[model samples]
Target: MAFEDVVVGEARPYADKVVIEEYDPSWPDRYRALADQLHAVLGDTLRLVAHKGSTSVPGLAAKPIIDLVAAVTDSAAEPSYVPALEAVGYRLRVREPDWYQHRMLRKRIVDGADENAHLHVYTEGCPEIAKNLAFRDWLRAHPEDRDRYAEVKRELAKREWRYVQDYAEAKTEIIEDIIAKARAAGVEVPA
Candidate 1:
């Protein structure tokens, strides 16, 4: 199926089934360790090392993966940072110049292995980061909404998908809608 064809309502069957382990209280520690590793390599090139996505939200059921957002001041000028990140096990996966010039890298389990964690690098003050963080925070505050999302994800994991990215894009609509509610409630949408 095409990327846009994967919606939360329809793509539930194709997502990989991930057992919802008990919310790890140590997720913060994980983020800190990972963040330190990132900072050690990038140093001044790193603008922010934020714990983002479902893992960053307490009480949320995540796929045992830490999602990080690293903001750089200027992506075009920071070519060295990409190679630096690659040296530390992060492989560039997605580059979207049209979408806020966003760049994404994923940490592989081993050489030529599937990704275990995702690091999203963007120019400092990128609007996408705000929306992402806001969505996570909003879900943390709303258990019913969070539960609903978890249900969709769990169901989606049972289906068949050509690529994992397709499964992720499927959740975009619900995510965007929840983000809208978050913005309406004055949850601090970053400019």
Candidate 2:
């Protein structure tokens, strides 16, 4: 599906340069707090929650936004969880039913801190969950690829992007290459 079709609400153009910040030691704590909140809200529906993306990897420069993955019973069944999430200040931003029933909800200005986070929701057993975890674990164990990804992100951040998603899309090639290497090294990347 097209980007326009997948987004739940407004497809706001970023219209700004991406900002990549040096890794912060406190990122994991922030992720844990958010994960805790998700657990509280999601309860039995939540299957698993994980910290993914660059912020999850220590020493990796990132956009300062925490990226989290929450595996649930059924992501496409929004009525089961979306309302509860919204009640707790999360706004459903993206819903890509065509792509593993993926849903992305975002929380801005987390806990009064000038920070944001994305919660990517997918069904339990989705291969994307394993792929995300594998990517994060690979980067954590391999500094060479981690630094390479950081360099690529820094370079991409230098250019203007119409949408933040565009900036994310730009990193796909490098991400795939790294994941391929991870798979070659016995990492479990579900097909």
Which stretches in model 1 have alpha-carbon errors above 4 Å? 1-22, 112-115
Q: 1-191, model 2: which lDDT tens digit per residue?
A: 56778888789889668999999999999999999988998899999999999999999999889999999998889999999988887888898878899999888883553348999999998999989998999999999999999999999999988888889999999999998898888887976
What would you estimate as the lDDT of candidate 2?
Answer: 0.90
- Residue 95: error of model 2 in Å? 0.8
What are the models' TM-scores? 0.83, 0.95
- What TM-score, to 2 decimals, does candidate 2 have? 0.95
Candidate 1 residues 45-159, lDDT tens each? 8989899987888887777778999889876554768889877787776666667777777786756634467888888988888777877778888998888777777776666
State which candidate has the highest lDDT: 2
lDDT of each: 0.75, 0.90
As for candidate 2, its clashing pairs are: none
